[model samples]
Target: MSEARKLLVLVGSPRRDGNTAMLAEGVQRGAAASGTQATLRFADDYITDFLRDCRTCRRSDGECAISDRFRTLFLEDFLPADGVVFCTPIYWYGMSGQTKTFFDRTFCYYAGSYPQSEEVLEAMCRKRIGLVLASEETYPGAALGIIHQIQEFSRYTHSEFVGTVGGIGNRRGEVAHDPRDPMRGAERLGREMFTRHYADYRADTPRSTGVWCG
Candidate 1:
């Protein structure tokens, strides 16, 4: 067996064990089946009251200057993780505030004053990104904008966009009842993600380099 890849899962639902959480757990379960080490972080708790100010955000270090709950964890865990999964509930055709805001904080990586700032930012972009969303609507269009945002973000950072899975639900744990069996699809996505072993690739140089998408 190959080395197990590390996956950082960000759950954006205020309800820790809500529908989105269950869907995320399906992905985790599938990743584990393929020998992946998946870490789940609740984005609702991870996002703090910290707002952005370029002066304060672009510190010497490649991290957010604000002393918030997510600052240290994002900088530390993100560096070592092989892939990231943003599991969010749809909010008015957009991602949950917790999910979008957390991603906005990534601006600190490219804005930092460190000499290797660009290199660090580029390296940070190498990880694979996946999305898991839950919406109350029956139509899949609710996740369109959110999907486009991830696609654009991946293009900007040079990260590989894996794919997205969406479910229809409103009440807690309702995603599990999705007629399409979304949890199974989520598990399959997670399993296939690591089966390719693309997450293990690393760019050792601090300069510009290509990322492994497969």
Candidate 2:
């Protein structure tokens, strides 16, 4: 059997019981069923002040210049995960601002600011990534812009973009009631996290944003 891996799920929705959160919960359920250790965090739970531009702060050590909750999130929570799952609700054709804030904090991992970035960043390369997104828009491409960013980020970080589950619902907790069973798709994607490749899985199918399941 594969050894248990630590999976970190980041819920980017400020609404604790929103559609995205339900998707995240489904993923967690699947992770737990597979006997993987999983942890869930809300983006709003982290203190994300606007990244102050400065030259004299800490950078060479490969540490974030900011001394807020973001630093703790990076050094303690994010880096330690063997895999990461990003669950967000689309807003204005992009991820929620709170979630974006967490992502924007990655600049702290740059060579100048974070001297040990190479080590931590290299460690991240070994991890896998999954995405679960919800949107109010019903169009097939509603979440593509956000998905593209995530795909690029995965590549830049050297993490394998394992799979995605994009759901559509304007109301809170609609993911559970969607006809397509997006929660089921999210759970399946989570279970497949230990074993599948997104490229191979989507090889024969055309990319469609309306397609919520993997």
Candidate 3:
């Protein structure tokens, strides 16, 4: 039998058991049921330092200069995964600070500052990416920024941007009661993360007229 696929879920929410966490848990369960090995990492627990300067304390081996738990997590858990899901609660119409910081630190790998940049890029090209967002606002545009960012990230890495799940909630465990039932959508996204291929709208269709559909 072929080896099972690996999925790394990076939760950028500070709350341990909040609305965002609930959506992530649903993803984990569905991924597990689909025979994918899903690993969840809370960003607040591992990522401590914000990336200030890539050249300040640059390592000779081309690794991130900042000394933090994220270094190990990126090298061991993230780089090897077949798929990656970024789960965050929307903050001020954007991704959470933790999520943005994580992406900012990844500049080293894609900027050719890393010794194994070619290999890392190759791995990224083969992976699939997904987004999970939790927001208090039911407004359609609330999660748009996060979605666009992830979509562009996937394009830059040459990875497939599978899709997204946006959960509307504020209180702890409130997402479970969202009328839209985003928990189920999160689960569906997880199950299809590795198998689904979304066509690029820019390449396959006419430019959008900025109309809000959701």
Highest lDDT scorer: 3
The segments of candidate 2 whose C-alpha lies over 4 angstroms from its true place after superposition are 1-3, 54-65, 198-214
Q: Candidate 1 lDDT, tens digit per residue, 85-200?
A: 88999889999888877877766655545455666586677678888999999886778899999888877767788878888888888888889999998898777664543332
Q: Candidate 1: misplaced stretches above 4 Å?
A: 56-63, 114-116, 196-214
Which candidate wins on TM-score?
3
**lDDT tens string, model 2, 98-150?**
88888877666654556676776776676789999998777878788888998
Question: lDDT tens digits, residues 69-157, model 3?
Answer: 88767778899999999999999999999999988877667667778878767766757999999998989998888899988888887
Per-residue lDDT, model 3, residue 28, is 91
Q: Against the true structure, candidate 3 has what lDDT? A: 0.86
| Cα-based lDDT for every prediction | 0.78, 0.80, 0.86
What lDDT, from 0 to 1, does candidate 1 have?
A: 0.78
Q: Flag clash pairs in model 3.
A: none
